[model samples]
Target: MTAPRLKVFSGNSNRPLAEEICQHIGMPLGEATVTSFPDGESFVKINENVRGHDVYIIQPTCTPTNQSLMELLIMIDAAKRASAHRITAVMPFYGYARQDRKDQPRVPITAKLVANLLVAAGANRILTMDLHSQQIQGFFDIPVDHLFASPVFFKYLEQFKGDNMVVVSPDVGGMKMAAAYAGILGAQLGMVWKKRTNATTVETVNVVGDVAGKDVLLVDDITETAGTLANAAKIMRDSGALSVRAAVSHALLSPIAYERLALGHIDELITTNSVPVDTRGLPIKVLSIASLMADAIVRINNNESVTSLFKIKGF
Candidate 1:
């Protein structure tokens, strides 16, 4: 008995990351034609046969969220129609994730809707990283391999390990994530209490833990307008912290984010290449998760557990 062949394809969302993943996996990316018509309809045509093969489509629903999402669904449907044995939607940065719940009346749970759309489009499983909320995994009935970028961040953040370091969550909601980093780095934990003034503005009110004279490292799952992070950093700086930095999983930086980042509240911003991020000459460090994702893909194909991938040395 032989294992089914594994094939990886990518949409236009994050092609560079996909190419890097294929390079790490030592396989060529499966060819596909993903384009738009003049009428603005998404079209996907798999150039290679995937019959009885294990297929994975890499498409992060970022920037042009709707278009990227539609392309992924079409690609999945094409692979399903081609008789693929299994299909996995590889979304490095799951967009619409922040809308997992309805905080207001008459608001829809777009995260759940996206999950249903993927499953309806013939996705057998999902492989994604650093979702905005863990509960989003429950939105799907299919198997979900949720990988974290912590291990990668841990390796890069090793240099900052010291008694003077304090890990802080930009908001109360990210306290859990901040605690994990603090524990692994053997540092103190802290949090910022922030109120969302609007979709793109935030007001940081209070600090939960001590940051005085400590090198503060703020952690979060995502940042769009940079409001939460910037405000948190301002409060941390005003609180007598020696320095303030940030480690975010996804940097969906917008023009406003760039403007905020330019204010120089945070010293350094470390994040992953989960989505397309342009530094625009800011103090930002982008790490690659290609090897991390490629290893998971190979393990999944071989029916092996990916538990070890999450293990960080000295943690």
Candidate 2:
């Protein structure tokens, strides 16, 4: 059976990653005019005909969150109006995901709201990675291919694992991710108890597991202000950890985050280029997930199972 023609386009947020994905998949990126009007409203026009073609828009709602989100929505709407056979939003980093729940009164579940926005904009499918919470997938009625960056991390961290290594979670919220990394690396698991005094400050209260004389590797889904990672690394070192490192899926480094990491005890901050992050001479190493995303895209285009893309070698 012949497969439908596939086309991919990118928004302004992370065009490099999208282009890299297209390169790995052996396809040229689709042409589109995605710009903003003088009034700050998004304007999108598909340059080429997309009628009956399976169209995918690679737009991660990263920094300048509102602008990126609007661009994606407008592009999806444009694809629909162009009579595309299907429209998939491939978001490498989903913004506003931290607002997935309303633990307090008068708060909105913005994650679910984003999902609704994508659906309303005529997105036929979603391809995203390492959401703040996995349940965000259920927020969408469309088929969602949620890929993980663990395989990429594991592959890179293999050489760094040692005899007395311990995987630590920066906070209780990240215990699940830490456990997964620990299991894959065959290391001990630990956690740091933290209290958020403010949005920008995190106080490390205690260490939950044994880390004395062990090389510590902290894992988390994201890090913006670096408050949690910096604080946890300090406490772990004070508690007798021989070395400290962190592996975060998203490193949306702010000025505050960069300053903190520059002075913090963490020996390294390993992250993925899910968003645009520049180390600028800090102890930060970025691993590429473009290949992972490309493999998933190819499988999705073939209507084939994408489970194997998550597999790590020898584990």
TM-scores, one per candidate: 0.98, 0.98
Compared with the true structure, the alpha-carbon lDDT of candidate 1 equals 0.95
Stretches off by above 4 angstroms in model 1 are none
Residue 257 local lDDT, model 1:
94
Error of 2 at 69 (Å): 0.3
Model 1, span 159-253: residue lDDT tens = 99999999999887898998899999999999898898889999889999999899999999999999999999999999999999999999999
Expressed as tens digits, the lDDT of each residue in 1-315 for candidate 2 is 666799999999999999999999999999999888899999988999999998999988988999999999999999999999999999999999999998899999999999999999999999999998999999999999999999999988998786699999998988889998998898999988889999999878889999999999999999999999999999888899999999999899999998999885999999998998899898899999999999988888888899999889966
Question: Worst ten-residue run, lDDT, model 2?
Answer: 1-10
Mind sharing the TM-score for model 2? 0.98
C-alpha lDDT score of every prediction, in listed order:
0.95, 0.92
